[model samples]
Target: MAKIHSHFDHVGSYLRPQALKEAREAFAQGKISKEELLDIQDRLVKELVHHQVENGLEVISDGEFGRSWWHLDFLWELTGFEAYQQEASYKFHGAKTRTTNVRLNGQVAENPNHPFYRDFEYLLSITPAGVTPKVTIPSPSLVIKRDHRSDLYADYYESWTDFLDGLAKAYHDTIQRFYDLGARYVQLDDTTWAYLIQQLETYQDQPEQRRIYEEIAEDDVYVINKALEGLPEDLTVATHICRGNFKSTYLFEGSYQTVAKYLGQLNYDIFFLEYDDERSGDFAPIVDIWNGRDQVELVLGVITSKDPALEDIDAVIDRIQEAAKLIPLKNIGISTQCGFASTEEGNILTEEDEWKKLRLIKTITDQVWG
Candidate 1:
């Protein structure tokens, strides 16, 4: 809703050093109370919001302050699910696999309260005098990726139509409730579709797995479209798709060509695509759907958030100009390739370094869009 743009990342760094150190130590010793943890989070979040506003960012997020991982924990809050840490491994760059018993799943046990709404409610108290805050949540489609849920079986919803419809309703209800509370922008952090597109090889290696991957991609679009069925025409809803961002490295790397057809049909107001490096591929495929009738805007990730190196503002402007050849400049904007903190593990950059990246993005954007 604001004219200036900002990147989303971790809120942990925004905490007062003493408070953060205390929280970490207390959690480690299992000596902290939930209320104490939340209280510190609240103070940190308020400061985070003020910091963003001061730094010249247009839209503000809670910096995903309270959650551990961006997608999973929120997916757990959706409905009929429980989450727990479990042993699992993910392939990192250089073909290295990291194994950790991180948070995995249980079931869609009950429809507990949505964290997006509760967090926003807490954030409302800290919003700056005039700035409108933006809320970001993992896409509802992420539920498909959560550690094997029993209810999501072969005949889970009686029919594919029923399953999709339910998903749409749940997301729509959740987002609408937030909109009703004065949120002008709601962003769906959809890494599921992006990952499916990039990991085709991983799925293709096993015939049995390919079908599940295809179904999830198709169903993600269906569910997202369904959720957007009816809502405020003026409320801006955006989607940020990334291959994966963990500890300054990536998991999947590819372009939109794999899912371009479905991606072109999404119903969001804007699409924040990761185009920071060669791994994202050329922008030609994106140009194909850039002028579609659905009224989608493109928030180009021209600045690399993963590395500490600052982009030459002149070169960044040239790329934006280059992208305009395919899509109108009016429909384009710039941001970091992904959030400063896609996960708690965070990018390898220091807090000072991370903010420097944001500053560069803001400076370049002012030059190009001003």
Candidate 2:
């Protein structure tokens, strides 16, 4: 697999266009047929691909136009999982999302008929010759860590470890399916690891709570690596580690120092890390874990996707230089801290603001890496 050594990259996803959003709502209420809804999605996605190329992004996506939420839509499509209503929505800094979550229906397994496989085919179909069409799904770690239905595990698996293996197998087979379909680049958007960082921080004084979070963190690392097993070498895989992003609100804040050891053990070609603000902390922990791994690129998210304001290019360059003191500049890339829309609700930013963010990144990448 060749490295994604491009100086600029993006966390895959864009704000869902209003037409597609309205079409989805109408379908839910039975005002439109599935075929009609799909027609809107197909048309919107094609326009998104063209706009992405025009905006100068070498890597692009379908804008996740067909989904309600970034991770939940993908999760529910997998076998043995179904979307369920939770009593409380995910708590964020200033917002509460719809009361949505997932639950286990049976022992987790791969669904060959998974919609993402078909979606990836569409993405490949419309992508131009030179641009990279990236497929973003919630990480395998997410499926394991987000399973809150503990009582149902007894009906599905022999032990907790077995359940973990089941989740990994599902993702492993599913990811392989994507690769077989001509997907050269895949990005796993993970909040589990970053959630662990927050847990350890919030529970630092409580030994029991701290222990539980630590144990789950270790389990997540195992599940993730297990899923990547046996995949071909030429497939470029990356993981974007971020705290929850929904409606311009975040779930937690912390340093990578908490999860440095686990980050070192993962087998990914690149790490699309969140460093948009002080919340992500310094790059020393990154240096400690990623040192000497020349094949990997530490793509920094210096620009804020959660807000409409653009970052000062020179200040962004200064931060990259700061990270360069630890990791080589050649191996460091630049991107928005996360996607413009991690969920279909989108961030507080507008479509034009999103494009400006990309243009700013292109300007920065050209100046630093040219």
Candidate 3:
């Protein structure tokens, strides 16, 4: 088996082409057939894969083109989850997102016929040899974190641990399915960790709030570890920590200090952390947790994806070197802080800018790592 490296990685999601978005909307409104919608997705994904290869990236993804929302799309495909438009939208910083909410409708179980299976198959069919095909899905913690009304499902689960166990089993089966389909590198795009950091500010003054935050932090690690159990040794698990990306506006803000100790508890091989700005805080805490671990790698997101402005190469290199002072240089990699498009809306940047950002990552990565 080829050893998977996190060098010059992307967070998986890419900006959706306008035509593809329109086609999806049409399909939702009953104007286009599912086949027609998929055809559009297939074409665009082919182009996206080509772009990734042309950019000199070793790992390629389907650009998550087959779905609308990143987490909701996958969750809704499960046995007992249902997606519905909520009455209110998620209010981000100076931006609003579409009100798509997923609810627990039945018992959660893995659906063997999940559409992402076919999406990955299409991506693998088009990818060239030597380039690894990667698949990104919402971490199991997101499912538990977003279950805002679990109380309503009291009849379904007897306790919180029971609910988490079911979700973990479903994720384990789903991951095994992806692995069987030849996905050696699987990434879990998680924002729940960042949300926990945001809670630090909200509960700093109250002892009870602080206690609850600590409990959730522990639970977050438990859920992720459970989901990762019993996987093949050759399969590489990566996780991308997100601080929210929609229309270029962020949803949460904080440093890793709040969660630094818990970081080592996650069983992922690589961690694609967001450090594009001050909102991500400094890298000292990362150095503290990852100091002696040779099996783990860190892909520091030194480039910003929220805007069109490009970062200076020298400055980015300086930051990377600074991080190396703590973590070993060999275990470090480079990538964007988050995906260019966490949702269908994407960030406030042009397609050209997005490509340039990726190119910039490759450039910086070579200069630093070489």
Candidate 4:
């Protein structure tokens, strides 16, 4: 099994074109059939993939055009989970998100007919010959942590340990299925680790909150490792740690020092870390964990996805060199801090701006890695 490396890659979700959104709404209103809606999505996805190729990206996603939310959509597709409308929305910095949530509706199990596999298949069929089709799913810990309403799962499992056991087996089986379907690279999009970092600042003086944070961190490590157990060595597993992005607003702000120890224990081969601004702190914590581990590479997200501003190429190159001093230059890569749009609304940037940002990423990557 050969290791996979790339100078530049994206964090998955792209802004949804207005036409596709209209088509989805029409389908929901019963004006169009499921086939009609899929046709619209297929056309839009092809255009998005073409743009990715045109921009010089080595890896491509379907732009997540077929779904509403990044993580919730994937979770709803699995067995034993149900999506419902909540009374209140998730509050972000100066913004609010959709009032949607998911819960365990029954005993958890891996659905052999998960829709994401089919989505990946479509992406693979249309991708260019040399380009690798990457699939991104919410990390097992993210799902388990978010859907933690006691009332929702108490009836389904005898204890938290029992629930975790089922969740881990389901994820392990799903990853194997992904490999069997020709997926060589899969990324686990996780924000729980970032949330934990934020909690450290919000509850530093509170002993109870500190204890809760430590417990969740431990569970996160256990669940993620269990989910990745026995995965094929050739399969490239990457984890993207984000601080929540919705319409250019963030849900949390803090440094990575709080969760540095847990991050070092993750089994992922690549780390798509958010480092576009001061909120993410410095690279010293990462340096401590990386410690010359040649197998682990860092995809520095020095470019901001939340804004349309183009980064200075020379400055970006200098930052990459600075990171190289901590980790080997050969193991460094470049990407956006987060996706252009983590949800359907996307950030407050024009489509043209998004393209410019990607082009900037390629330009910086070439100058540094070449």
Candidate 5:
């Protein structure tokens, strides 16, 4: 629907490593206060904003540097939620459940000074006079999934319907606020749908959980579309769905087939689907779903972020052609499977390697879309 524009997911690396390392080491040794650390975080934020714009990137994020974790800290920072730490067993690929204490929500508060609000304000203030920068927030669907604690919520919220209703309302309000502050592109980073796909084979074993996940997928679409409902039509919205890209370990593995219903019916203007490897299965399902929809756009993730080796240009082009066979070539574009750093702990690649990967993406985009 638009010209061949290029954007990336999770581009900002870390909180300016040099400043962070110095500040962290000093703070750990009792040389700096929390305020001082946050001050350094602010400086790093500016540097990151500049770096993202300078890297030939049109869409920019805070690189998620200010917070400790990507999803929870920001969700915790928002008003209307009291977050506390709890350890749980979450599986990733072949590994056993690792004990990680992530933030869980209890209540919602109202405030004019939310961290995400301030994060967007600060970025807007520092952005060069004319450049429009995009702000990313974890998908409300994923946030609800992350905050799902059966023990705490089953008693208070009483039923799944009430809980999801509130969850959807919170997100709708949050996006409204962001839109008021000049956010043109709001990318919802989510993996819940992928998680559902990954556990498909075992669905029969947990019939109730399967039902819950199915509802979650539909709720995910409903919440996003609800949030987008009265907003300016030009405020381009897109979604980046992934199979948990943490430490290169995955939580889901399958093709676009598992989630084709939602993918085909999603109300967003654009969909960024993962097709970097066999772990993502085939593109045939998406091609079938996308049939006859000229308005929806697809970003084909042809470059793999899992390894350091660069992809052969010809092979990359061939993959694009394969995907184009399913979805119209005009509706498809290209990008990496995931970001260089989906979390605070960056991926295994060196910073230089990350740029190389991006350069290749740019090169291929120029050749294919031009």
Candidate 6:
């Protein structure tokens, strides 16, 4: 077991093992009990934590095994939201997800009894000593970005400003709870930053849409920062700007240049950015946001989690050196562009392929940073 002192990390989610997937399906189909399904998830997650340590990872996640979609499950479980089926599923590049999304139904607040609390507890119980247990959930920005609001939102809250205030308070409460639970490393897996940047690009000519998105991005930063204010310095909060990962496909592309103003203002301790392909554009955005700053660390997601073919180690090392010119080598790290699975579908790569990728990241980080 190793203490978490470097940027050698991965986005929290991993490929859900086949047995856990089957157990979830069985429970859905009324073929198994809920307890039985959780038993399977618990067993598989323990194995995942051990697997991660063996691969040289210092931080261990539960692999998001307790739910289906990484963001949706966590959002709907909160106090004032509920899940429902839409007329059509969310369309990804080459795949469409199940027709499920959350809708805000009441005054948004934190549920003192979130299931993730227990799920993270189990992770801590089984995690080997010195390997930091990381608790990951959706960011506060996502509930608003994903359009989980229905007309019913107006019924519970008088104005949009009131709603946002509640959201920030709820997130603050939830994060404080995590700290109390002995969680030092918590990651907010977010797609809102990418969504905002994409929207800015999508509606450049439309003044109204541009203004609306710009406003939303600012509010998003405010909420995240407010939730993170006044926390213990020892708690390391990280965020990932996912560009929609589903079955080896993505929904957003382009650089981080447009959203630098907002990204630079976020209060998180680290940023896990995607640089797996040219679609991520240049590292120029690094300078745009973090120029001359050493208080925060930046982890380059140089490996492609969507693809099984291992990256060339020499090429990867060269790319890292290229980024090091912008930021100090001590404050830089390597990881996959996103998790192996944003949902339970778990990417198109085999589980063995994932281990090889992690090993590559470990080797790259050690050789470059050591």
lDDT of 1 by residue, 235-293 (tens): 87888887777777887777777777778878877788888998888888776546464
Query: Model 3, 1-370: lDDT tens per residue?
Result: 6459857888888999999989998998999999999999999999999999999899989888887788889988988788888888876899988888888887789999999999999999999998999999998878665546344356688888888788888899999999999889999998888888888767888989788878878887898899898999999999998888888888888988888789878888999999999999999888755747888889998898998999999999999889988888888888899888888988888889999999998888888776
Query: Per model, how many backbone clashes are there?
Result: 6, 2, 0, 0, 3, 0
Sort the candidates on lDDT, descending order: 3, 4, 6, 2, 1, 5
Instruction: Provide the TM-score for each candidate, comma-separated.
Output: 0.86, 0.97, 0.97, 0.96, 0.86, 0.96
Candidate 2 lDDT, tens digit per residue, 109-161? 88889888877899899999988888898887776556474446668899988
Candidate 1 segments whose C-alpha is farther than 4 A from its true place: 1-18, 21-25, 94-112, 145-151, 154-156, 201-213
TM-score, cand. 5 vs. native: 0.86
The Cα local distance difference test for each model comes to 0.70, 0.86, 0.87, 0.86, 0.68, 0.86
Candidate 2 Cα misplacement greater than 4 A, ranges: 147-151
What is the total number of backbone clashes in candidate 5? Answer: 3
Off by over 4 Å in 3: 147-149, 289-291
Better of 1 and 6 by lDDT: 6
Against the true structure, candidate 6 reaches a TM-score of: 0.96
Task: Give the alpha carbon lDDT tens digit for every residue of 117-236 in model 4.
Answer: 888888888999999889899887766556453246668889888888888888888888989998999999988988888777788899897888888888888888998999999999
TM-score of 2: 0.97
How good is model 4 by TM-score? 0.96
